[model samples]
Target: MKIHLSYGKDGLDVEIPERNLAGVLSFGASTPLAHPEEAIARSLQEPIGSLPLGELATKAKSACIVVCDITRPVPNKQLLPPMLRTLEESGIARNKITILVATGLHRPSTAAELDLILGQSMVSKYRVVDHHASVPGEQSLLGETKRKTPVYIDKRYLEAELKITVGFIEPHLMAGFSGGRKMVAIGCAGEETIKTLHSPRVLDDERCREGSIDENPLHDELMEISRMAGHDFVLDVSLDANRNITGVYAGHPQEAHAVGVEAVRRSVRATLKEPADIVVTTSAGFPLDLTYYQSIKGMTAALPVLKKGGMLILAAECSEGLGSERFTAMATRFGTATEFDEWIHQHPVDIDQWQLQECLKAVRQGEVVVVASGIRPEHRDKLFVRTAASVEEAVAQGLQKFGSQTTIAVIPKGPYTLVEVSRTSA
Candidate 1:
């Protein structure tokens, strides 16, 4: 059986023996938008739970548009032009409008990357800046939320009379879903603010799981932070497996994001008959799998459908290496997953520790084998996981360890699709 898994830009294909293969899991394909530009324009013209974007922009002297950084697969090129036109038609000058890249704690986008994210023409005409979380002076404190989370956002974003956020809606590891309040709460927030929200105590909550929102403390805290930051109009888009825009939610941040989440739920949710002994998955391909830190999402997504003591083979490009020094340090400091959990129990204030902890949670579920061309073999050891030269080699080792009859599953799209094993199977 030949199966193609989402790898770098082109994708990677592997041939598995028919007798060894169990099933290939993925999200149900959704209908792509026939006219993305027209849909975006229409959404802006008739926004939900609020007045149209043009009407809202009328009284504002200056506007700030926040967008996701390079790590996300948001169709900014398709969404931004029409949004800018709407603001322009409402009397807001292009010079007065600033496009802020909500980078969170991630690195700033490069010139070429920014051109791809916002288009070369838009970059030259409008002011496009990256949010700097490490710089203290660039952020302003907006007081604390009810959960006592300190809210510090970019001062320039706060200075704008009107704030608008654009993002792609998808299942997130920590926040249940990504979009709406998250663009500001995490994207434009200062380092301290991000640290507070990503703290171990907050992430340890049961409701913080994927696809959950109502009682999710992380989502609730972000909502509170967004409310304190003041009213923000949002434009959230949902894409199909092919990365084409399938749904667009515009207007009030919270309400519109809810609409997008429902659309995403319908597209991503899948049920598996049983857990697999060996699962092979990818980190959702290029851009997303650019670094090891981001690649962890694919492992977490595959964990639910993997049986205990099973083998998990992850194919990630990780072209940027470990991505975070703090994360790498955390992994190296603790020898095993248990030791890492012990350290977190004793001290939970460290930044980026939650990500390492989350990675460890998936690691504890099964043995992990990585096939990363970008990560060095020596560095792979520090991650406390075995390394393989290719996906075929990893699967061959799994078969040898678990025997040929072991059920095997493949998640080609990885984190892009959620797998839920049936209760009867458990």
Candidate 2:
């Protein structure tokens, strides 16, 4: 059987033996809006649980719009224009309106990348700034949550008379779902705040996994942080597997995000009768698969459909190699996931340790093999997990390890498409 997997800019096709194939899991195909930009404009005018964006903008002098960095495939070019136009037309000065890239703890987006993120036309016209989590002076303390998680948001966002965030709704490994509160709580949070949110205390909770919302502690914490930061309005969209806007939600943060999440849950959830003995997954390509740190999401997202001791293979471009300096150092330092977990428990949460922490979850569950061509030769062996040269080679190794009886499942879209075992079949 020939299966095409989402990898890098151009996808990859590999031949999987028909006898071993369980199924290719993917999100339901959603039709793209016939007039997406017009749909976005209408969503702003007729929003849920709040006044229209234009009306809201009229009241505030300065507005701050937070957006996800390059890792997420948010249609920023489409989402930004209509909203920015509304703010400017409603009396907010062009200079007073700041588009803050919520980078979290990731590296700042370069000038060239900014052009790619928000088109050169928008970049030159608007006040665009990347949130620097490590810079202390850039953040302002917003007090603490009920869980005592410190809330430190970007000063530019907190100081703004009107706070807004634009993101797409998708299943998130830690926050239950991405978009809404996340664009501010984590994206615009300071380093200390980012560390606490990613620390084991929050993530170790069983409810923190994907597709969980109501009971997710991390989700609740993020909402609290967003509230303290005065998250006024949100404009979030739901995208199909092809990255086309399927649904546009604009209004009060929690209310509109809930609407978008419901739509996404219906579209992205996929299921199998039983756990697969071997699973093949990807980091959903390009911007997401650019680094190994981001690639870990592919592994964790497939865990629900994979047998506890199954051989799991991940294919990521990792064009930038291992990741940030701190993540690369931590990844190479510990020889095994067990050792790494032990050390992290005893020490303070270091920068970029959270990605490795999530990686440890996958490592503890089963054997993992990473197929990434961009990694340097020396760095391959140093990773906590094994590395393979290609997806075909990784599959061959898995078949050898798990034998002919082993069931193989493939998740071509990886983390973007949520997979789970059917309760009745189990």
Candidate 3:
């Protein structure tokens, strides 16, 4: 059987022997909007749980719109035009409207990346800036949440008379879902705020995993932070497998986000009858798999359907190699996942450790092998997991470990597809 996995820009095609194949796991079919641009316009006009965007803009002097960084495949070009036009037509000047990229703790988007994130025309026409979480002066203290997580948000966003966030709803590794308040709470947060939220105190809880919102402590904390920062409105969308707009949700932050989450939940979920002895997956391609740190999401997302001691194979482009200096240093420091996990528990939370912490979850579950061509030769041996030359070689190695008859499952879209086992293995 031949399977095309989401990898880089063009994707990857690999042939697997038919005898060992369990199934090709993928999202349930979802229809993309026939007229997405028109749908977006209508959504802003008849937004849920709040006044129309134009009316909200009419009452404000200055406005700020937050957008996700390059890591996420958010359709900023489509989401921004209607919003910017609405704010400008309602009296806010071009200069008064700022477009902030919610970069979180990641490196600032480069000039070329900014053009890719927001169109080049949009980048030049508006005051487009990346959030610098490390710069203290750029953030304002908004006190703390009920959980005592400190709230430090971008001053530009907090000071704006009208604040709006645009993102797409997807199953996040932590914080349950990725849209709504996350675009502000985490994206525009200061270094201290970002570190505190990602600390083990919040992420250690199992409820913080994907597809869990109501009981997710991280989600609750983010909502509290957004409210404290005065999150005014949100325009979030649900995307089909093709990355086409499937649903457009606008208006009140909480209400609109909740509606979008349900729509996404109904569409992207995939279930398996039993655990697989061997599983192959990807990091959902392009910008998502650009670095090894980001590729960890694909591993954790596949765990629910993987048997204990199963062989997990990942194919990520990792065009930028590992990740941030902090993440790269910490990731290669420990020889084993247990060593890393123990050290993180004893010391204070450092930048980017949470992702490694999540990565260790999959490591503990089973052996992991990666197929990445972009990594430097010297750095490849330093990885905690094993490395492979190609997807075929990785699968061949897995077959050697578990034998040729092992049941194999494949997740083509990786983290984007919410994979779960329906029943306990006998």
* TM agreement with the true structure for every prediction: 0.96, 0.98, 0.98
**Steric clash pairs (candidate 2):** none
lDDT of 1 by residue, 1-426 (tens): 889988877888887767977778887879999998899999998998989999999989899999998999899989998889888889998899999999998888999999889889999999999999989999999888888888899998999999999999988877888999999999999998999888777877767877779889999998988988875699999988889999999999988989889889889988778898899998999888998888888888888889999999998888887777776666567667777778877874777676776687678889998888888666877776677999889888888999968889899988888778866574
Residue 322 deviation, candidate 2, in Å? Answer: 0.6
Q: Report residue 371 deviation for candidate 2 (angstroms).
A: 0.4
How does candidate 2 score on lDDT?
0.91
Candidate 1 vs candidate 2, TM-score winner: 2
Pull out the clashing pairs in model 3: none
Candidate with the larger TM-score of 1 and 3: 3
Candidate 2, position 405, lDDT: 84
lDDT by residue for model 3 over 342-374, one digit each (tens)? Answer: 898899989889888888888889989888887
Q: Candidate 2, residues 1-426: lDDT per residue as tens digits?
A: 999999888988878888999989999878889999999999999998999999999999999999888989899999999999999999999999999999999999999888888999999999999999999999999799999888888999988999999999999998888999999999999999989999988778889998889889999999888888898899999998889999999999999999999999989999988999889999999889999999999999999988988888999989999998888888899888888888988999887888888888888888999999888899998889999988889889888888988799999999999788986444
Candidate 1's clash total is 0
Rate residue 52 of model 2 by lDDT: 97
Q: Give candidate 1 misplaced runs (Cα > 4 Å).
A: none
